[model samples]
Target: MFTKILIANRGEIACRVARTARRLGIKTVAVYSTADAKAEHVKACDEAYWIGEAPAAESYLHGDKILAIAKLSGAQAIHPGYGFLSENAGFAESCKAAGVVFIGPPTQAIIAMGLKSESKRLMTEAKVPLVPGYHGADQAIDLLREQSQTIGYPQLIKASAGGGGKGMRVVKSFDEFDAALASAKREAISSFGNDAVLIERYLQKPRHVELQVFADTLGNVVHVFERDCSVQRRHQKVIEEAPAPQMTPELRHAMGQAAINAAKAIGYVGAGTVEFLLDQSGEFFFMEMNTRLQVEHPVTEMISGQDLVEWQLRVANGEPLPLTQEQLKINGHAFEARVYAETPERDFLPSTGRVSTLIAPETNDFVRIDTGIRQGDEVSMFYDPMIAKLIVWGQDRTQALQRLQEALSKYYIGGLNTNLEFLGNLARSADFAAGDVHTGFIEQHMAELFPEPSTPPDEVFAAALWCELDHTQARASKAQRQTLDPCSPWAIADAWRMNQASIDPFEFQVGEALYSIQGMQRNGTYYLKLATGEKPLSGERIQGDEWQIVLGQKTLRIKIIQSGNTWLVFWNNKVWHLNLHDPVHEADDQGVHGGGLTAPMAGTVLDVMVKVGDQVKAGDALMVMVAMKMEHTIAAPKEGIVQEIYFQVGDQVKDGDTLLSLE
Candidate 1:
C-alpha cells in the first residue's frame, strides 16, 4: 500500500480521494492553485503545496510540476482524480519515468483508449458490438462530408479525443452538414487541441449504460455491474442510478463480458468505465471508455460496497483483486443527483457567486453528501460549477427515489442561482419515476418538468408576510440599539406603534405573477389575508437561516434568505424567489431605457460579429462571451445601427457591462 500519495486534483474529487486515503492510514498531499489556497480539499489532506495560478493550464495540467511536488513531499504515488491529468497518457508515462506510481491505468491502456476513433477500432477487433460509423483518419473536409452522407441523417459528429459534449454535434440533414462540421471542429480544437472527429449513427432512443470494470497486475479483470446515466442535459449526465432499473441477468452478463473484453484488449489496469448505448431493440453499441475514476462512481460504490479509490491504491501497490467476480453483489438500488450552481431555466448556464448559505440534509448509512466546499465558498468561474453530489439508497428503486426526493427538499442554497428546483422537479416527474429515460429525456419531458411560472402558492404568500414582519422587528431593534437613550422610545427614531388590527399591506412577484397579502397580528398567531382567504401563520427563526413555522394547524420547517428586495422562501422541496413589488422603487429605477446589449455574466469576449455603424435587426447576434465554458451570445434588442462597440474580441467584461450600444 502507498505510504503517502499526492492527489493531482481539486474540489469534490480531491476530497473524495483523501477520504479513502485516510481510512487506509495513507498520508495524503494536496496541490492547489492561487484561487484554491483556502479550499476544502487543501484542509482534507495531510500536507499542501502551491502550484500556480487558478487556470488549469498553469496548475493542474502541469504534470512535471506535480511530479516534482510528489518527490518533494515523499509521496510514493500520485492519484489524478478524473479530469486534468487523469487520462493524459504522457503524464502517466512521465510518472513511470519519475519512478512514482500513477494510481491509474498504465500508459499503454490510456493510449489505446484515449481517442474515440482508435478505441472504436480496437473494440471492433475485440469483437465488442459497435455502432455503424466512419472511424477513418481522413481529415479532408470533402472526405468528411462524403462520410456523413454515407451514414445517413441524424448522425453524430464527435470529437475523436474528447468527451463531455465539448466537441460534438448532431446533424439531422445533409444541408446542415457543412456548418455542423465546422462548428464541431472549432469547438473540438478549442477543448482538446485536436480537430479530428468521427461520424456515427445517432440512435434516436438509446440509454447510456456504462459498466464499471477493474483490472489488477495479475491480469485479473472483473466488472462491477453497471450504472444507467440516461438522464442528461447538454449531453452531460444529471442523474445516475446503479443496477439499471429493469436490467435482465442475460443482458447484464453479455454487457459485462463485452466490457471485460475491451479492458483486456487495451491491457487496462486500475479503474475504467466502458460506456454502452443500449438501443430500444435490446441491442447495445460501444461508446468510448473513460480511462480514470468517474464523476458518478459513488452510485457504483453505494450498491457494490466497494471503495474504488482504495482498489486503485491496492492495485498500484501490485496487490491482486480484492474480491472475485462471483463475490461481488448488488446490495441495493442507489441514485446520485449532481447539485450544480447553474440556472436550469436559462439553458443550464453556469452561475458564479459566493455560496452564502448551503444547508444540506443530514446524511446516514442510506444517504450521503460528497462535497469539497463549506458555507461561504466561492463558486469560481475558473472551473466546473458542481457544488456537491447527493447520493441515496434503498432496498428498491421506489424506496430510493422516495429518499432522493425527500433529501432534495431539505437542501437550500443561497446567494446565487442554482438548479436545486430543477433537480427536485426532475426527480418527482411522472416519466422519470416510470423509468422512461434516455439521452433526450430532458428535452422530451421538458414541458412537465419545466412548467411555466404560475401564481404564488398560498404558503409562499404567507411566508412572505412573515418575512416582512420579521424585517420590521429587526429594523426596530437595530434602531433602538443605535440610540443614545435606549430607555426612551423617542430617542430610538422609531415611530413604532402596533395593534392587533393593524393591517400590514404587502405585495410581491413570483416571476411575473403579482400577489398581495394583509398580515395582522393577534394573540400569539398572525393571520394573513391572501387571494384565497385568511389563514393563521406564525414563524420564528430557530437557528441560522432555518425557520419553524405553523400555518393554520400544520407545522413546517423552512429557510428564508433576503437579498436586496428579493426573498427566497425555501419550502416543500421548492424555492420561491419573491420580489417585493415596491412601485416607488420601480418607478425610480425604470427612469431610463436603452438599446445597449450587455454581458449576461463576467466572461471574455470570444467574437464580435458586429462593429460600429453596423445595421442590425432584433435578435441579430452581436457579441459572443464565454464564461465557465459556456457561451452566451448578446443579441440586438431592436432594429438599429451599432453606434459604439465598447469592448472588442479578447476583452474581459463583468456581468451587465454593455458590450455595444445601438442608435
Candidate 2:
C-alpha cells in the first residue's frame, strides 16, 4: 500500500477519497483552485496545495501544475476523482513518465475508450451490441447529412470527445438536422476542444443502465451488477437505483458478461462504467463507456458492499483482484437522489446564495448522506450546483422509495431554493413507483410536475402558520430581554386572554385561496394552533428566539421577519418573500414580462448569436451556455429586435445575470 496519495480534484469527490485513504492509514494531499481555498475537501486532507484560479481550465485542468504539486508533496500516487483530468490519457501517461502512479486505468485503456467514435468501433469488434447509427469521422457537412439520411430521422448527434449531454442534440426531422448539427459542433469545440460528432439512433423510450466493472493488473475482472438511471432531465440523471427493479437473472448475466468483454477488449483497469441504453423491447445497446468513476457510484456501493475508491488504490499498487465475478451478489435495492441548488418551480434554474441554515436528517439504519458543505457556505456560480447526494437502501424497490421520501422530508436547508420537493414528488409518482421509467420521463410529465403555484398539503400549510406565530413571539421576547423591560400590560398570564384578543389575525394565501390563523398567549409564550372542528391539528415549539415545527412528516426551523408591512417566512432552503398586500384576490399574471435574459444557471457563455441588431424568432437560439459540462441553448422569449448583448464568448455568468435584451 502506498503511504501517501494526492487527490487531484475538489469538492465532495476529493473529500470522499480522502476519507477512504485515512481509513487505510494513507496520508492524502489536496490540490485546489483559489475558489476552493476554504472548501471542505481542503480541510479534509492532511495537506493542501494551491494550483491556479477558479476556472477549471486555469486550475483543475492544468495537468502540469497538478503533476508538479504531486512531485513536491512526495505523493506516491495521484487519484483523479471523476472529473477534470480523470479520463485524460495524456495526463495519465505524463504521470507515468514522472514515475507517479495514476490510480485509474492505464493510459492505453483510456486512449482506446476516450473518443466515442473510436470506442464504438472497438466495442463492435468485441461483439458488444451497439446502436445502429453513424460513427464515421468524416465531418464534411454534406457527408454528415448523407449519413443522417441513411441512419434515419429522429437521430441523436453526440460529441465524439466527451459526454454528460454537452454537444449532444436530438434532431427529429431532416429539416432540423443542419441547425442542430452546427449548434452541437460549436458546443463540442468549446467544451472539449473537439468539434467532432457522430449520429446515433435515438430511442424514444429508453432506460439508461450501466454496469460497474473493476479490473486489476493481473487481468482479473469482476462485474458489480447494474444501476438503472432512467429518471433523467435534459440527458442528466436525476435519480438512480441499483439492482434494477425488474431485472431478471438471465438478463443480468447477459449484460454483465457483455460489460466484462467491453472492459477486457480495452485492457481496462481500475473502476469504469459501461453504459447502455435499454429500449422498450428489452434489448440493450452499448451507449458509451465512462473511463472514470461515475457520479452515482453510491448506489452500486450500497448493493455490492464494496468501496470503489479503495479498489482503485489497490489496483494502482499492482494488487491482484480480491474477488471473482461469481463471488459478487446483489443484496438489496438502493436509491440515490441528487439534491441541487436549483428551483424546480422556476424550471430548475440554478439558484445561488449562502446557506443561511441547514440541518441534515438524523442518522438511521437505511439512510446515508454524502455532503461537503455547511451553513453559511456559498453555493458559488463557478461549478456544479449539486449540493449533495442522498442515498437510501431497503429490501425492495418500494421500501427504498418510501425511505427516500422520508429522508427528503426530514432534510432542512435554508437560504436558496432546492429540488427536494420535486424529488419527493417523483418518488411518490405512480409511473415511477410502478418501475416505468425512461430518459423522457420528465418531459412526458413536465406539465404535471411543474404546475404553477403549486400548493403543499393542507397539513403543511397549517404547520407553516404555526411556525410563523412562534417566530413572531420569539422576536418580541428577544426585544424585551435587550431592554430589560417589564411584560406588556396586555400580556396574558396563563390561558387565552380577552385583552390580547385585539391582536390582528395573520392571513396568507397558499395556492388559490386564503387561510387565517390566530395566536393564543400561554405559559410565557404564544401558541398558534390549527383547529379542525374541535381538535387542534398542529403546534410550534419556541424557546428563547429559536423555533422548530413539525408538519406532517417534515420538521422545520424558521425565522419570520417584517419587511415594510409585509412578512417574510424563511425555511427549508427558501425564503417566501411574500408581498403581503392582500390575503385574497391576486391575479394569475402569465404574460407579465420579467426584464432581460438572465442566465438560467451559472455557466460560461460558449457563443452569442446576435450582434445587437439581428432579427430573431421566439424560439431562436440566442446563445449557448455551458454549465457543469452540459450545454443549454438560451433561446429568445419572443420575436423581437436585439437591443444589447451583455455577454460574449468565454465569459462566466451567474444565475440571474442578464445576457441579452430585446427592444
Top lDDT prediction, candidate number = 1
Per the 3 Å backbone cut-off, how many clashing residue pairs does candidate 1 have? 0
Worst 10 residues of 1 by lDDT: 584-593
Worst 10 residues of 2 by lDDT: 529-538
List lDDT for all candidates, in order: 0.88, 0.81
Alpha-carbon lDDT of model 1: 0.88
Q: Tens-digit lDDT track for model 2 on 451-523?
A: 5664434444444556555455676666656663446654422234456542335676544555565544444
Task: Summarize candidate 1's per-residue lDDT along 526-641 as a digit string, tens digits.
Answer: 68887777888888889987787778877777777776688878776676789889876663322115867766677778788987899999888788777776666677878999
What are the models' TM-scores?
0.93, 0.89
Off by over 4 Å in 2: 345-347, 452-458, 481-500, 509-516, 520-595
Please provide the root mean square deviation of candidate 2 (C-alpha atoms, Å).
4.5
